[model samples]
Target: MSEYFIAVIIGIVEGLTEYLPISSTGHMILVGNMIGFTGEKASVFEVFIQLGAILAVLILYRDKFMDMLRPEKLKLVNYKENGLSLIHVMAAIVPVMGIGYILHKPIKNHLFSTNTVIIGLLLGSIVMLAAEKFAKQHLIDDIDKITVKQAFLVGLFQILSLWPGFSRSGSTISGGLLLGMSRKSAAEFSFIIAVPLMGVACLYDFLKIWKLLSISDLKFFAAGFAVAFVVAYFSIIWLIRFLNKSSLASFAIYRFILAGVSYYYFFIR
Candidate 1:
């Protein structure tokens, strides 16, 4: 297969799993392995395409982004009084940003293996299943009403996603639910928080690999990025609507099946 074709396949996988309770990185690694695309360049490609996914989030939540910039709403006292503000986002992002930066090298070196990803997928699914079953109370119904305490706690939960298959949205949304947030509210907040977190991570990786990119590589990356953007935009919309009416049991079940398949192929076989 051509590099462009491989790019499209990887992009679709990235978009489909990026926001779902499933892990995008895990899917990418699995696909990359099968296609013989694993290496530093492949890792760089994975991070670059996330920018496309984040673009979908920004476009979907353009109103929230604009609200953060309005002159009247810029005041500290009025922050989040109008709607979800940048400050609230920063609160939820700070913990992960700090920890992620400090452990970036270690995580990249030690946890980027197929076995670790399978374990993360299985363990994270268990956490999601348990949180959905046991979390019965919903203290918050709107993303705007999320308290600082709740935001920080959600950030704390995001730390778990440093592992390959433990998804950022899954950990934070599960944390939000366990901390008394409604499903829709938690999902929305999870989406909002992902914007900045992914943006910085993408930028960092781009800088690291910028020197290695060629004209041919640009064409491939463009194809993947555009495909990821289009698919992720629709995926986010569908997921938000789905969360409004359903539990995450199906996602948890899918994760279990993925983990089993991965373990069989990578270890047992």
Candidate 2:
């Protein structure tokens, strides 16, 4: 396939999975490998394309973030009533970010492989199933009601997402469910936290690979970026609606199937 066509294909996969508790990076790695697009250039392309996905979140939750700028909104005890401020976002990201930073080198070098991603996919399905099965009863449906305690615990689940196929949304949503948030609420928070979470990680990766990029490559990157943004915009909406009436069981099943397919293709074939 032509490089631009590859970008579009991978962009669609990134958008469809990026926020769905199905691992976007895992899908990208597999798709890239199949399409003959794996390497440093592909890595940079992913980092850039993910930014487009994050932009959808920023725009969708612009009001919540804009509220953070208002000085009068952040009274000491209003965390439960003000929707989500920057504080909640920070709480959800710190644990993962700290641990992720420390382990970044080792993870990037050793774990970004099909074998490891298969393991991550299998493990993450269990996390989702367990979260649904043993989830707390008192549903904190509104993001406005989320507390620092809840957010922090969710952050800890995010640590699992440092593994490629572990799915940041999957891990953190399970954390949210286990901590008493409703599934929809958990998915919402997952998308919200993803803005900063993805932004920082992508920025860090971009800095490392920036010099490898060429001016001639801008169009390809733009193609992926634009496609990811548009598709992710709608996926986020569909997921929030989907969670309201359904459970994570289907997604877990999907992950299991994908993992099996990946293993058969790479190992058994």
Candidate 3:
């Protein structure tokens, strides 16, 4: 396939999975490997495309973000004590920022493999399923109702998402659900958390690989980025609506099947 064709395919995968309790990175890596799109350029492409998804979040939540950016709102330290603000989002990003920075090289070099992704998918699936079954408190329905404790704990759970297939959305949503957040609220919070997490990650990777890209590579990146942005915008809208009346069991089961299939193809075969 042409690189452009592959870019569109991967972009679709990234957009559909980025906010759906599925790991976009894991899916991109798997599909990339299958199509022989591995190496520095492909890795950089993957990271760059994530920015598209992040942009979708920013556009979708512009009102909330604009409110947080108000000079008055910027003064707060913990927004949960007041209302949902940039502070709350920053707090939720703390754990991932610290942990992701320390482990960045290791994750890129070693954990991006198929076997690691399969393991991550299986483990994350179990966590999500268990969280749903055990959650006793489903009282917090509003995103503003999220407390500091919940934000910090959700950030800690986000640490697990650094593992390729664990999924930032999946881990954080499961953590929120376990901590008494209603399903819709948990999913919404997960989307909000993604903006910073992916923005920083994409920027970091772009800096590392920017000097190496050719014009062709740039074209591929642009195509992928545009496609991912459009698809992710709609995907986020659909997921939030779906979660209002549905459960995450379908995603968990899908993860299990993905893990089994990956293992069989990449190892057992």
Candidate 4:
């Protein structure tokens, strides 16, 4: 198949899975390996496409973000004591960004494999299930009401997502629930924080891999970015609606199935 065709396929996978509880990294690893697209360029392409998904979030939540950018909210330490602000999101991103930066090379070197992704998926599934069963609080339903403590704890959970198949949305949403956030609120915060997490991570990766790209690869990358952007926009909309009336239990089950299938295909085969 053409590389462009492969890019499209990967873009679809990234779009559908990126913000879902399902691990986009795991799916991309499996699909990339399946289609013989596993390599440096492919890795860079995957990271590039994530920016598209981040852009979707930025546009979808433009008003919330604009509020965050207000002059008064610009102070690094200033934030509403009870109301959500830029500080809440910062608290949620700091832990992962710090740890991820320290362990970047080691993680890329050792944990970016299919076997590890399977393990991550399985472990993440358990975490989600446990969070659902135990979190009866559901105290905070409004995103604007998220406390710094809650956001920080959620950020700590976001660290788990760096494990490739752990799923960033899964970790944050589960953490949010365990910390007393309603499902819809948790999901919204997850999507909101996802923009910066993905944006910084992708930009960092792109800087490292820019030399590997060329003008000839432009169309391939563009196709993947555009498709991922469009699909992820709808995915976000659908997920918020879904979470309002549902739970993360279903996604946990899907992770179990994907874990089993990925293990069989990649390691057992």
Instruction: Give the worst 10-residue stretch by lDDT in candidate 2.
Output: 72-81
Q: Count the backbone clashes (under 3 Å) in each candidate.
A: 0, 1, 0, 0
Q: Superposing all C-alpha atoms, what RMSD in Å does each candidate have to the true structure?
A: 1.3, 1.3, 1.4, 1.3
Report the lDDT tens digits of candidate 4 across residue range 1-269: 98888978999999999999999998898889889998889988999999889989999999999988887777656676436677888899999999999999999999988889999999999999999999967779999888888899999999999998999999999999999999999999999998887888998999999899999999999999999999999999999999988999999999999889888887787
Q: Per-residue lDDT tens digits of candidate 2, residues 44-71?
A: 9989999999999999989877876567
Ranking of all predicted structures according to lDDT, beginning with the best and ending with the worst: 4, 2, 1, 3
TM-score of each: 0.96, 0.97, 0.96, 0.97
Question: In model 4, what lDDT does residue 158 have?
Answer: 95
lDDT of 3 by residue, 1-269 (tens): 88899889989999999999988888988888888988888877888888898999999988878877877667765444567777778889998999999999998889989989998998999999998899758989998888867888999999999999999899999999999999888888889878877888888888988887887677888999999999999999999998888878889999999999888888888
Greater-lDDT candidate between 1 and 2: 2
Model 4 spans > 4 angstroms off: 75-78
Model 4 clashes, total count: 0
* lDDT at 167, model 1: 90
lDDT of 3: 0.88
Computed on alpha carbons, the lDDT of every model, listed in order, comes to 0.89, 0.90, 0.88, 0.91
Clashing pairs in 2: 83-144
